[model samples]
Target: MTSCDRFLLDQPGGTLNHIRPVPAALFLAASLALTGCSQASSSEASSASEDATTSASAADFPVTIDAANGEVTLDSRPERIVSLSPSATEILFAIGAGDQVIAADEYSTYPAEAPTTDLSAYDPNVEAIAGYEPDLVVIANDTNGIVGALAKLDIPTIVNEAPATVEDGYDGVAALGMATGHVDETAEVVADMRAEVDEGLAAAPQDRLRIYHELDEKLYAASSHSFIGSVYDSLGATNVADAADKQKSGYPQLTEEAVIAADPELIVITDQVSYTADDVANRPGWENVSAVRNGNIVTVDADISSRWGPRLPQLIESIADAMASVKTPVG
Candidate 1:
C-alpha cells in the first residue's frame, strides 16, 4: 500500500505498504499485488483430504476462495497462521481466531496478545516467515514474490489485500473467518459493525460539514473516494480535497493555499503527523479558516485512520465526537 493518506502504497498489507509509484497505481496496485499466487501444494491437499475422513465431509474439506491474489483452496483449517498484513491481523483476532494465529508482523499492535515479531511487513523475510512453519500465510501485498517462495515449500497462502471500500472491509472479515474456521463469530462482528456504524453516523450534522483529512505533515489529503474518506461520506460530510483530486486518485497532495481556500469546517490530522493542532491554526494563511478559528481540528490515530479493520466503529465514533462539537456551525 503506498501512502494514500497513510502511505499505504505498496503497503501491500497491515495498513500501508504502498507501492511507491504514480498516484493512479495506489488503488490498482493494492488489488493487483496479491493476485496470481493462490495455489495449494500436494502435501496440503493430501492433508486436507485426510482430515475430511476423521470427522467432517467434503463440503468443509476443500474450500475454495477467490481472495485478493487469486483463487486459493484450503484443504483443512489453518492451524499455524502468519499474518503479514496489519489489517489482516486485526481481523484474525476479532473474528475469534486469535488462538490460531501463531505469529504476526510487528505492526500488529492491537489486542496486546498478538505475537508481533521483528518481521517487517514491507520487507518480509521469507526464511524468517518459514521459521514459523505456518500452515497458512496471509499478506496484503505480494512483496518480493514471497507467495511463490512459500508455495515452493508446500505452504498455502491467502492474500488478504487491504480494503478499498466499506463493503470490502466486511468481505475481508467474513473471508478470514472462513479461512480460520470462525464463520459464526464473523457474522456477529459484521452485524455489530453495521449497526454501530449506522447509529454513529446518524448523529452527524444533516447540513453536511466540509471536512479535511490530513494524511501527513506534507499536506497530502484523503479524497472523498478514499476508504478513510468513506467514513466522512457516511456521515454526509463534504471532502474539501475532492475538488483538488484532479486525477480522482483518491489521495492527493495539496498546496497550503488550496487547503485554506477550501476553508473546511473540520480538519482531521493523523496522529503520525508532527504538526500539532496549534501549529495548524497558527499557519499564516489559516488564521481565518473556519476549522482553525473555531477549534474544529481533530487529531486522529494514524493506524486506526488508515486501516479498514475491526476497529472501524472507533473511527465512526471519533468522527461523531468531532461532529458533536459542531453544535451549530463553526464556519
Candidate 2:
C-alpha cells in the first residue's frame, strides 16, 4: 500500500509513533489524532442507482468500475448500501442516497441520519458485514483489503481511495456519485464545494503566510502533498513542515526545535487536546515563536479539518478567517 493508504487505515487511539511517519489515520477516519483506537462507525448512499431492477436494466445492472482494490461490478441498483468511510457516508447523504443506506461503519457520523453502528472499518469482520445483507459496500482501501475479503463472500465492494489534492477530492466524489447512481447530485456537490472554497480563499492575502497545521499535540504535521496541505496551498499558506528534509510521507513528525526554528506566523490546530496555546507559549525557548508571540494560534473543527469530504470548504473558510488575524510573513 502507498504511504497515503497506510495513513488512512491507522486509527487514532494510541500515542503517536514519533520514530516514523505515523499514519494519523485517526485524523482521516475520525476527527482527532488523540484517539488511538481504530473504531468503525456508520453508512450512507447516493442517488445514482435508482429503483431499477436487475432484469429491467441488465446493461446497467452490472455497472463495472475500477477502484482502489480492483474493478467492482454492481449487479443492480443497491437497495441496502454499507459505507465504511466517513467521507463516503457524507457524499452518499449529500447525493440523496441516504434512504438506501442500511448500515454504516462507526465513524460515518455526519448527517445525523446515517446508520451509525458498531461495525468496525479498521478490523472489518466479513461475517458481521455479511449479516447486513448489503448489496453494495463502500470502503477507503487502507492497509487491509476489506474489498478482497468481501469478494470471497460473493459481496460487491467499491474502494474510494483518499485524494491527494483538492481536485483529486472532486474526482473521488464524482466516482462515488457514479457508484451510487447519483451522478448529477455529485456534480452539484462538487460545484458547490468549488464555489465555497474559491470564495473562502479569495480573501487570503497575496503575500505568503507561513503556517503550521498541528495534526495532534505530538507535533505531527501535514506536508504540502497531503489533502489538508492542498487546502493550505490554496489559501497561499506556506507549510513550515515542508521545509524539513526528513519528511518523506505527507504526514511528518517535526522536532520541537525544527518548529521553533521555522517560526511560523500562523498555527492552525486541528484537534482539541490537553495541550493548548498556553502550552505552546510555555515551551522552553518557544516563547519567541511568531504564532505564539502574536497570539495567532487557532483551533479549527477537528472533524471537518481532518476529513477531505463535503466540509472541505468549511475548513478552508475557517482557516481563511484565522489567517485574517495574522500579518503577512516578512523575510
**lDDT by residue for model 2 over 143-246, one digit each (tens)?**
36677778888888877776778877876775565566654455467667877888988977766888998776667788787788888888898899897625
Model 1 error, position 322 (Å): 0.2
**Model 2, CA-based lDDT:** 0.68
Total backbone collisions for each predicted model: 32, 19
TM-score of 1: 0.81
Best by TM-score: 1
Candidate 1: regions farther than 4 A off: 1-59, 327-331
For model 1, residues 1-331, the per-residue Cα lDDT tens digits are: 4344234631111112111112112222222222321222356553432332221221354555567677666777788999888788888899898998999988888779989997877888989999999999988888899889989989888887766667767777666765666644665676678778878878766878999988777788989778888788888889999998988778888999999899898999877676788888888989889898888888978778878888899998898889778633425
Best candidate per lDDT, number?
A: 1
lDDT of each: 0.72, 0.68
The estimated TM-scores of all candidates read 0.81, 0.79
